[model samples]
Target: MTQSTVPPLKVGLVGFGYASATFHAPLIAATPGLQLAAVSSSAPGRVHAAFPDAMLYATPEALYACDDIDLVVIATPNDTHFPLARAALEAGKHVVVDKPFVLDTSQARELIALADARSLRLSAFHNRRWDGDFMTLSQLLAEGTLGRIVHVESHFDRYRPQVQARWRESGAAGGGLWYDLGPHLVDQAVQLFGPPATIWLDMEQQRDGALTDDWFHAVLGYGTMRVVLHASALTAIPAPRFTVHGTQGSYVKHGLDMQETALRAGAALADGWSADTSDGVLALHTAQGVVEQAHATLPGAYTQYYAQMRDAILHGAPVPVTAESAHDVLALIEAGIASAREARVVQLRGQV
Candidate 1:
């Protein structure tokens, strides 16, 4: 069969909130072989602003029932991720869920089993792996520019003095900055260095009117290498996004990836966006002295996630972010939570 003859994969986005509007809907629309078939949102005007011709359903189930929607992208609250994904899978549709895949590893395993039994594609949206800075850092590590790894620090700090009124801060089962940002950090670390041997965590509710943890510090041990993952809502002074110390020297990067910021600013597609401006400073120890240079980050393309999702559904390719990998990410998150509550390091011998 000819490639062009196959119909475009139709996607049903389950929400039109910040995540759906800012990330999923736009990326799905931007990809060539995928179409925004429908959306389940109470705010039709909001969805119409972006997808003028696309269908709008009053509820997600209504959108899922339409055979036109071959895939369902769940961009709802953290607590709803599990049930919504399960519903989408039961409707005989492929699924792509937002990160922190679910509250625990058990839920993730259930979803994974369902998708496998149905012979359908299922993936978690660990889209931060495509962040320009992260991609560049991955390249450097692969090329051995950083020599043997020693220590790593990753921060996703932000300046939010006042805790806003949202479900994320409602201290629910899967609320707080830990679930919101920890998934990204933990997934990135695993991508770079596999799973860790042990993890110790400390979490706090530092911001005013904060009901849940707004700050967290997690230390993960990988053999001799130590990986520290942290995120806070009370940082006036921003920390470097990444800091890597190796035998050769260090690579310190400041500023977050620009793609999310740009998409929120209403860009059509964040392609070919340069990273020269927010380059990471790479320092190497030399015989005479240390040499420092700015390392350029690869352009971030979140569009790749949907593109690969399209391929996996249409061409029988491997899923972009497998449910099992996301399950592993959840293992680390749950471990961190346990570590914080018990005030001890959690071993991952059988956890993952």
Candidate 2:
């Protein structure tokens, strides 16, 4: 495949809710190779309010039919992700599906197969992998500063004691904390340590009126190493972002990176945006006393995802987030649900 990097690709987004409005639009607008060509939403006002120059479609099907759009980004809800993405690929467009790529492994695999048959680029928006704290941990692991990490812990906790009346809190296909936040934790674990031998999951609805699980605790077993991933909306005081233990020493980091907040607050992402440090605390033990490092907060670069997607489409660069990797994440999520349902450990077969 002869890929050219000189030309930018036209990108049509399929939703205008929080994910699209807050995350997708800004990043797509900021990225160089991708233009915000069109968007589909019944809430045309929402799309028009944010992207006045972009064409507006009444439905995703209409968006997919746009001849000028080179890429399609599905930032719609969880249940609609698979079909919408499949439609885009079948329409000969490169596709980017937001997190939890789909509700099940079969859906993910099907999309993979379809994308492959068409030779089109397919990617998942596993953006949390680029979170500042995660990057720091990845750096430490790469440098062997943590020295053969035997244990890893990641938490995405919040203080929402009351379950809000939203689709996410509803007892539906993609509802609840597990589907909402599980992908981030699972993907991070997979990214750092590979797949696990088994997974032990404890999921429950902690709030009084909640219909779905609001809390989740999963232990992904990697033989000698164990990764403990947990998320709860009831957490008033959130736990550390990362707490890693290795044979030689340990490293602990507190607080989520500020880029998401910055994006939500409409901050411009120029001037080394991701390299900024607003929140990070790292403590490592070394022979030269306890080596402590505070990561210069990296600007969250959601735009990088689109840039990579553009490269993959125009230049045949590797898709930043592949469908197969996302399938594995869905498998783990299914296994987690099963583990919690049966009150037994889910035996995972894949390695990394």
Candidate 3:
């Protein structure tokens, strides 16, 4: 039997919301080995306007069934992630699901099993791991400049006081700020320190008439080390993005990387686009004394995810954000939800 040559991966996108339009689509189109073949959106006209050369499908099924599309990137609502990803995998297409993975661990496991059975690449778009500030921190940690991490604090705060009427504000599966931002925080913790022995979460709805949790604080207990993950919709005065205390010194940083904002503002991916970012304020506590703040360079590369995904599909490279990592995130989310419901600490089992 003569082997067939596989052309470049044809990528299909679902949903044109903030994530797809700003993050996924632009990054996918910028990636070299992938092509924006089609998009499934109810607002077909808008999709056509954004991607004039790409085919527009009235339904996700239509997009998935197209013979030309080799990968499906799901950027839909939290509730639809499972169903669409499952359908894509069953249809023999490689799948990339946006964050929060799914509402529950069972669904995540099911999709994992399905992808494994089909020998397909199944991944979550946990792109924050590539944040420039985070990249700097990762380097410091690996170089032992921070020594043993004792306490880590991560925050994703915003001033969305007037809750927009969306499924995220509703009391639905994968709803609210926790679901929206928890994956990034939790994934960072897991990447740095692995799984926790126990998790304690406090969640509430501070917004008027809000149905889902708009505020959440979770503490991942890793023996002596602790990671605090917090998010709130009512933050008027946003706090530091990252604060870490270690035996050798402590690091405090404020503000988010500017790549995503730049990408949303129609910045092209070429040149120094993704590599540029506002220098994060860094205050390091040394034995001599607290060092004065300095501009810490951030080398953000959001395009790296798509590039790796393309290579994984084309050249059999390792998928940077693995399904196992996503499973750990979902499991932590489940534990956090459980803790909030029962008002107690939840012990995590499996996946150490």
Candidate 4:
């Protein structure tokens, strides 16, 4: 029998909040081999307004029951990730859960095992890996431009002094800045330097009337190397997005990826869409003195993630972010929380 070409993968997105509306849906629509077939959202009208042709389901259970959906993207609240992903996997659909894959490693491992048993692809949306500045830093590290890295600092600070009345700002499970932004920083650090030997964390509720923690500083110790990840809601003057120090030099980048701002502003994907205009400073020590030069930022490609996911489902390519890698990030998050609660450094036992 002659083999037939498989049609585009039909995707059902769970949730229509900032992550789904601003990132997942848009990228899925833009990718070549994926179709935004349906969505499960509380606000059906909003989903229709944004994606006029998409079929809307009132609940994820209904969307999961639909036979046409080949893939499921979970962009709901962090606490809802585990159950929804498990259900999607049980339905025999490939899955993509947004970062902080689940609340803990056990839940992640369960989903991983189920997906593997079903021979389905499972990925985490660690989109910041495609950030323009992070791409540049990856290149520098790979090329040995920074020599032996000794210390690295990453910040995801914002100036939201007023606390909003939302689940993220409430005392609910999987709420707070650590669960909100800590995954990005922790994932980036793990990508750069693998799992740390020890984890130390400090967290606080800095803003007035803040119910959950809005500030966090985590230190991932890799023997001689130290990776510092910090995020806060009350940072009026935010620090550099990334700072790296090595035996030979230092690199500091000052801006976040532009794609997010553009997406929030209802901008479409086009030429130069993810380009970062802000240049980073790279300082090298020379015989004469220190030489500082501005390094041009690389163009971010968040859409590449969805495209890769498509290929992984259609052509047996590797998923962009593996379930195991995401599990490692979750382990780090758990360790950080424990360290904060116990006021001691938590030791990691196994590989990421």
Report backbone clashes per prediction.
0, 7, 0, 0
C-alpha local distance difference test of each model: 0.90, 0.85, 0.87, 0.92
- Per-model TM-score versus the true fold: 0.97, 0.94, 0.95, 0.97
Q: Tell me the tens digit of each residue's lDDT in model 2 across 82-162.
A: 889888999999899999899998898899999999999999999988887787778778989768889889998888988
lDDT of 1 by residue, 259-342 (tens): 888888887564464343687899998897899998877888688898889989987888899999999999888888889999
Query: CA lDDT of 62 in candidate 3?
Result: 91
| TM accuracy, model 3 | 0.95
Error of 4 at 124 (Å): 0.9
Candidate 4, 3-23: lDDT as tens digits:
235577899999999899899
Residues 1-352, candidate 3, lDDT per residue (tens digit)? 2123445689999998889999999999988768899999988887788899999998999998898899999999999999999999999999999998888889999999999999999999999999988887787789877678899899988888897878878887878888989999999888887889999999999998889889999999988998899999899998888888888777777887778889889998887886644555445667788675665666788999999999898879998699988987888888888898999988885643
Residue 26 of model 3 has an lDDT of 93
Model 2 steric clash pairs: 194-352, 195-352, 274-298, 274-299, 275-299, 276-297, 277-297
